[model samples]
Target: MITFNRVRSSILKAKDHRRQLLGIHETDVLRASIAEAPHFRALLSEIQAEAERARREPAPELSFTDFHLFAAQGTRIEYEKPYFERRGRLLALALEAWLHPEQKDLDALQNEIWMLCNEYSWALPAHLPYTLEGVASSRVTMPEVVDLFASETAHALAETLYLLEGRLNPWVVHRVREEIERRIFRPMFDTPNTFPWESSTNNWSAVCGGAVGMAALLLVDDRERLAGMTDRVIRAMGSFLEGYEDDGCCAEGVGYWNYGFGYYVYFAEMLYEFTNGKLNLLQGDKIRRIASFPAAVALTAPLYVNFSDCSETYVPNTGLVSRLHRRLGQPVPEMTAVPSLHADHCYRFPHTVRNLLWTDASLLHQPAAEGTFTFPDTAWIIDKHRLAGGLFAFAAKGGHNDEPHNHNDLGHFILHAAGETLLSDLGAGVYTRDYFREGRYTYLHNASEGHSVPLINGLPQAADREHEAAVLKQEVAPDSRLVYSLDLTGAYPKNSGLRSYIRTFEWSGQAEREEAHLRVNDSFTFAEAVNGVEEFFISLQRPILSPGSVTWRGQTGEVKLTYDADTFSAEAEVIESLDHGSHPLTVHRLRLRAGRVPGEASWSFLFTARAL
Candidate 1:
């Protein structure tokens, strides 16, 4: 059995010896390294630019109007925009102060840190327990709860104190430690389970546990207390790992794989350092497979298989990927672009710091991954073909509706050709109270209506754990074709009259001929004649409907979807919606309407993509 006994022993031995992890603790040496490294020049410029921006802007006040909006109304972005901006500013200003040691930067950093220290709760209102709204409304009195961001705030503050201790005013430094201890350490240690996330199997477990554990390592000096706390954290980390099956697929999709797994890696690095390399969490076959998920899911340089709540655009953290590559000898996708300073509005401290510490130039030069990757445990198949035309990638899923960040989209697929996603997954809807509550499926992105699947009796797929898709058959040819079939009958309710619904996808590609075709065949059986059936396919580009087919043209290529005109009629509808970023955009939904059909019927549509 794998255990952290060695970690506990190592921590017991290092009784007052505070260790620096992941980066140099001394400011002067760290600054010198940053100044001398050529690759770090761009990062330095970003920090400097953010410093200027921070200097120009006054910190936005976390006001009553904004803070109460989540409770008063169901909206979140009104408060979150300024809330994250404050954190981002603090991160940039602090890093700038540390690097340059300028008096002005230091002064601004002190003020930002002070402002953060004074906040009522480091946890966002959205993360608070629903019953605690009254306390949040007061904006002052509340029990300490270590949500994802609150724990992260504790780590950020503790690390700041660790790195810039002597430079900062004694009062500011003292207050920083006091706040973290009172807010994070005391609550977690005093009451073992301050939040239910300790046992959660999603990103919450990793983010909250990892952040608090890392903060404890950075702040707590008592050996016995640290060991007890660290043991609990290790258990939580284990729970996080249990969330993934043997195949190591993240059902929450790529964006979350970067997030939840990213934190696990960060905490692992710290633990490895704390134990003087005695406890290596990055070892083992399971972790190596988990580390390879991003490369396996990459459809293009900028896109990934965006199932569940993942964003269509996924930017791998270069530093984290490089660290994994160097540690485990795993392959990483070629990442040419660096994340901008504000790319992450939250300004995650560990991610930003590691982006400077762990990046390796050689790792960034690897070729993009190609060919088929399958995860039967999670029921995901991704195939990328490097054709003469460009690149043709097809991804599909057969998981249940009640996944983490669940969407009722079993048997949903994405088709990417050349540089465009002809048939797309809507990715994430804008996060709000209603978006996560009873009205969740009413949103376009969460409902099956927005996916490339068929509805039963004019009803969308249900959102229950039992509403799942079972893999009926799967095939991967050497280089020419891939086939996947799913039994989607359970995805709909009995009242919908659905007896059995089988979805099969045949993806065939010929690189030499620059042609790729995806055949989506759905066979349905009903106990009685259904009201009607509608097949919906989502795309970023508007579809042009012709006699018997619909064509979506992209800049470099186009996808022509041919269906039986005699059985179905096609039309295009535009939905004013939000992307993963919550940016307003128009989504083109192609609907194939079918009249009342017999108890047994089948629909097949062939999607052809070739060089334009």
Candidate 2:
């Protein structure tokens, strides 16, 4: 058992022997990587063209007032998000141009660099807490501080100074370092990060701590002081790790597991290399299991458990995934899609840079994994069947409602057949102030109603510590049927007149026949007769309805869901996906409503998700 505190004590001794081993120095990152790598020069060239195009357009007007405007508009993706992204990209271009000394317009980049260095605070107005908002007529009650993005913003400046040490004007580096100390270092490390990120169990701990830690390691001249600061960061990461169950489940969803954990690993790699492997940060069973999450949860190439605020269509860093696979001996997930190394999109920087630096092309050649994975830590069951003719899969979850990025979907499941999504989990919606404000579960995607679960007497599942699910049983028969049952009694309001909710899914696959199907049975006991129970299954494809069956036509093939017309009725509705998402998406909500029943009743349906 390696305690991070003990690691910190070792790191306190690290400064005495600190020497850079990051494969390339601040100066050679551009030159050496571009020379050795195939994709490196091309990405840099695209970035260069972007900077060239940007040279003609005046930078967008910046205002602290406009930054806070999105908070009132119920959107975080609109104005400020793009504006800061532009700023970060612009900074990267300047650094890139400096790295490419052959470029003719080096001074043009220097000008853009100066303009950015002059901005008030790199922190976005939208991320400001009421206390941190730089409002006039205010005696700031709290310390004038740095938020998560601001930490990265500061790192960008520090990283620029380090990378372009002699090439840039001396004044630019001095100004950047001064601001890093003023806005980031003094406020964050001088006092301490009592800000919730210090103890966060999610991405916050990694991005905030890792970004600032990289800055301290690169920019700070005080070796002993830097060691102490690095010591503190290791301790915060322990908090992130301590919250994980022994199963290495990232309850936040696969998207965030990639995002947050990516940063943690990024910092780990930097330290590991810097110490020449003396500090083995990648050690431990918890880490290996955490690294294996994507494979366990993935339903297909691009789909996985979108449990919390996680996304369904996401880009996993092939470099990071490959490294983890080599280390843990776990299967590398399929990631044929490429990723941008631009700073505008990264909550990950110095680490995301690894995507370009360490990506192994062989990762794409890894064999596909097909089998049953049971994560009892979070009560999630994933079964992938790779028949000779095609692929079919099913996934279901039964965790508490109070998970990180919590959603009120306890007994939700996803199904895929004929290589297309049939039943789906509409992952995260747009991020608005209200999304995180009061009444979050009211959002359909966050509520139980949006999931494939029954609403008891019109009351959706509750969202608190008390509302949770207990796994009753799980049977895995690989080549046959896989049945999983969970007790959902604790998921709803205690006084909702619902006595129990036992949701079960029996998935069967006939690999030899290229056929796959599922049976869902939900048995409930109520304190009294209820209004109605609606069972919903979300899908990417629209289903055509007949009397007793609904057939969903997708790219792969058609999936037919059959039920007794006399026992239930079905309907469908189309809803908008998240606005300004990475890709445009549309999905159908297929609802099956059963008439009111007595205190004790059961409802069941059958569907063929995959078949030849």
Output the number of the lDDT-best candidate. 1
List TM-scores for all candidates, in order: 0.95, 0.91
> How many pairs of residues collide in each model?
0, 0
Candidate with top TM-score is 1
Q: CA shift at 231, candidate 2, in angstroms?
A: 1.4
Alpha carbon deviation, residue 341, candidate 2 (Å):
4.3
Q: Each prediction's Cα lDDT score?
A: 0.83, 0.71
| Predicted structure 2, TM vs. truth | 0.91
Tell me the spans in candidate 1 whose CA falls farther than 4 Å from its real position.
Answer: 1-5, 15-19, 23-33, 36-39, 101-105, 130-143, 477-479, 529-531
| RMSD (CA, Å), each prediction | 2.4, 3.2
Residue-level lDDT tens digits of model 2 in 10-70: 5565643334534455545646655566645565665666677677666766665665566
Candidate 2 displacement at residue 421 in angstroms: 1.9
lDDT string for model 1 (1-612, tens) is 345576568788763345567645675776687688776677789888887888887898989788778887878888888878888887888787767665543777788889988887788878775555555664334537678888888888877877666788889988888888888887778664446788889998899888898888887878888888888887888889999988989999888988888999998888778877766778788899999999998866677889998888877788899899988988897686556676687889888878877777666646568888999989999988878767788999988989999989999999999867789999899898988889989989999998988777878999989999999989876765698999999999878888889999999887767978999998988888655788999999999999899999998878999999999988899999987668897999999999988899988999998768
